[model samples]
Target: MKRHFNTTGPVIPEQHYCVDPMTRLDWEDVQYLIGAGKFFVLHAPRQTGKTSTLLTMMDVLNQSDEYQCLYINVEPAQAARDDVSAGMLTIVNNLVEGAAIRLKETRLRDWRETIWRNSGPHGAFSALLSRWAQESDKPIVLMIDEVDALVGDTLISLLRQLREGYIGRPGIPFPHSVILCGVRDVRDYRIHTKHHEIITGGSAFNVKAASLRMVGFNRAEIETLYAQHTAETGQAFEPMVFDALWEDTHGQPWLINAIGHELTWKDKTARDRSTPITLERYRAARERLIYSRSTHLAQLADKLREPRVHRIMAALLTGDENLSGIPVDDLEYVNDLGLVEIRPQIRISNRIYQEIIPRELTWVEQSSITHQQAWYLTPQRHIDMPKLLSAFQQFFRENAEAWIERFDYKEAGPQLLLQAFLQRIINGGGRINREYGLGRKRTDLFIEWPVDEEKGFYGDVQRVVLELKILRKSLETTLLEGVEQTAGYADQCGADEAYLIIFDRRLNVDWDDKIWQRQEQWQTRSIGAWGM
Candidate 1:
């Protein structure tokens, strides 16, 4: 059977086309660390193939006849919550079953119950591992996947238990090496107990040798993965699709696979080997994926609700550098979760995340808007640019205060409100593309609408550029700078209609003083201007 892109679970080598997980890491160095009895961490944002990598390592070690290695997802224990005894019992039993199947070891069957009853809840895990290490012919290697999924007291207990075993490794004969895998670094786990005590994960697991962060596939790796499909089915991806996918996803493993799945398997017509995947199909599939709100994307959207995530995102949305009240530790915490890029600029991880942020932030407002799609269309079925802006201006004047109060990102409330309003109107027949970042102090939006409603997105496309800015300078100066910027973006997008929106965030500005309805000729093209 021919294999395809995998987004649902770990990639089985014989059943899927996958990059060798070891290639993504320093294999020899990692092996050396484990051989040297180093307990360490392996973590990355969800679905970036961290589990697959650990499974690969287990296969390599067990096959080499050097270690009795096993990979078990202890995330199931997360349900135990604050019940430490239940959680630990579930985790140790999971390890025993995993070893019985993976290592063909029946030794656990010999002493499993005795160890559980005698060692007590707190000591059961340590006792079980010690016995296994002693009974096994080879050194034992243990991996706990989704380590962060365990919450509160359960997480604290697990960490301390692991630390206890680590401290007695050589003499007590516990697992030679262990790996704790999850989305956050060990240093950032703010584990809280029911006793109202907060314990840092680092102090609980201080014996850790090193923490390794897994990254997304690079452009070359993406190319190789895609080429596997071509080799298998004789179906090729157009050259442009690779570059487009890279730009849109920035090598995020789950997005890459999800997009690949949508283009190849989800669309029946695109599956035939004779029919190649085109850039248009890729774009259309991508839009579908976003709308599908697949599990991965939904989880990404949910992170916006977290306080640490909200603090960083609120600042990024408005082009602010002052993270004044946010804790310093929050930065690494967000980065470990892969919400933003750290070096180039503190911004959303990629274009998809960037687009999803505002849309997710304003879902409530978008749903509440009374604007109808058909109402904004001219008799000819094209969007009436001036009419739309006029509607927004009225909406802003009457409802901005109430709507802005609902948002955590009050500084970027105006930009988000506008996008929410635009998103509601362009629901089906068009797509709105956004560009904003740190220090930019402006939001750029491009609306791509199908002019030939019958031919749909295939025929002539209507492109309009909307540039947004906050009024910090003279009205004349802001408009002058905005018109120039709008004209430049319009030229880039080949847009015929352009608009500049300036938001005056100053205190006590009269509505009559701020409202404006007019158009200015910038160079050869006309630009509509709105003030709020």
Candidate 2:
């Protein structure tokens, strides 16, 4: 069977082109932790190969005589919610099934019923592990995936049970090591109990030795994974595709595989295995993936509705540097969700996310926009950017008050509205790239429109840059800074035209006072400036 990219589940080595899951982490550290009989947490963002890594580790350990490892997902118990009995029953049953399937051990299934009857929900899980460990010749390692998916008292009970087992360790008949895998570290779990009490996972599972995060693939790993396809099919990817892929995905595993699958399997032309994939093909695939709103991307968009996610995302969207109001935990939470990176600076994780965030936020507005693409095109087939901006100004004046109030992220209303308007006009014929972050104080929008319809992006292309800013300082200072910033971005993009749009959101200001437009020159560039 031909190996292909695996996007949906844990990678099967013989069936998928993959990077070795073992190399994604520090195997040495993992071995040390396991050997020391210490319980640890392994976590990363969703679909980032946490389950795959755990399964691979289980296989490697089971192959040796040193340890008997079993990997099971506890997500099914999430449906039980606060019902500890139901949740624990589901988890225990899953363990029995996993042992039979993966370890070829039927002992768990034989012993689980009596153990649950005697020990009950609170102690059954720990009792089951203790029994399994006692019977096995090798020290057992239990890897529990999606540990955070359990809710309320159900989650609390599981953690407490794990903590109870940790007390026995190697001296007693308990698993030698326990690994809890989830989208967030155990320390970040804010579990709510039935009595309206809050129990932090750290407090419940205080026996945890360490938390190890699994990061996404680096450049070399990406290349190695992609090269597997080239070797098998004889279809090569152009060198430029790698650069674009990196920018679009930042080595995200699902994204890399998704794009690869789209290019190789979905597009029948590229399936010939002789037509080398090019930069244009990669871009088209990316747009399709984004527009498809796949489960992964949809989950990411759904997170924006969360209070913690909303706080950080709103700050990033409006370029608000006063993040003092947002808690550190909120930032870490969003980071763990894979929505934003909280390192050198807080920004959207990658270009694809950056595009999705704004687009998803304004999807409703963009859909309602009834403007025609041809209306904003010049007779020569180029985008009439000036006319487009003028139309937006009129629209904003008429509807900004009503539409802006409708957004959950009201602070970013102007910026999102402008993006929706642009996206509506450029739906098929062009693309817009956005740049905004914590301290940017400005949002940069780059429009790429292919002047020739036949050639698309390969032919004569018109590039336009729009810099969006909220009036934070004196009018003169804001205008001066806006012109320089807009000019700088245009220069970087080598754009044919540039515009500076300042949204004056003061309630006291009238439409006559707030709306204006002018042309300005900075250095060697001419920039159009607008006030709103």
Count of clashes in candidate 1? 0
Per-residue CA lDDT of model 1 for 1-532, tens digit only, reads 7798889789897888898898878887798899898999998999999989999889989899998899988899999999988998888888888888987787787777898899877788888889888877888889999999998888887788889988886778888999999999899988888988888899988988998999999999999999999998888899999988998888899999998889988988987778989887888888888878678887887987888888788777876667787787898888888888887767778888877788888988998999999989988788998888889999999999999999877878999999999999997889898887777778899999998877877788889999999898899999999999999999999998999999987778899888896788888999998998
Local error of candidate 2 at residue 357 (angstroms): 0.4
User: Candidate 2 — what's its lDDT?
Assistant: 0.91
Q: Please tell me which predicted candidate would have the highest TM-score against the true structure.
A: 2
Tell me how many clashing residue pairs each candidate has: 0, 0
Question: Which pairs of residues collide in model 1?
Answer: none
At residue 390, candidate 1 shows an lDDT of 89
lDDT per residue, candidate 2, 389-430, as tens digits? 899999999999999898889999999999999999997989
Steric clash pairs (candidate 2): none
At residue 186, give the lDDT of candidate 2: 91
Where does candidate 2 stray beyond 4 Å? 169-172
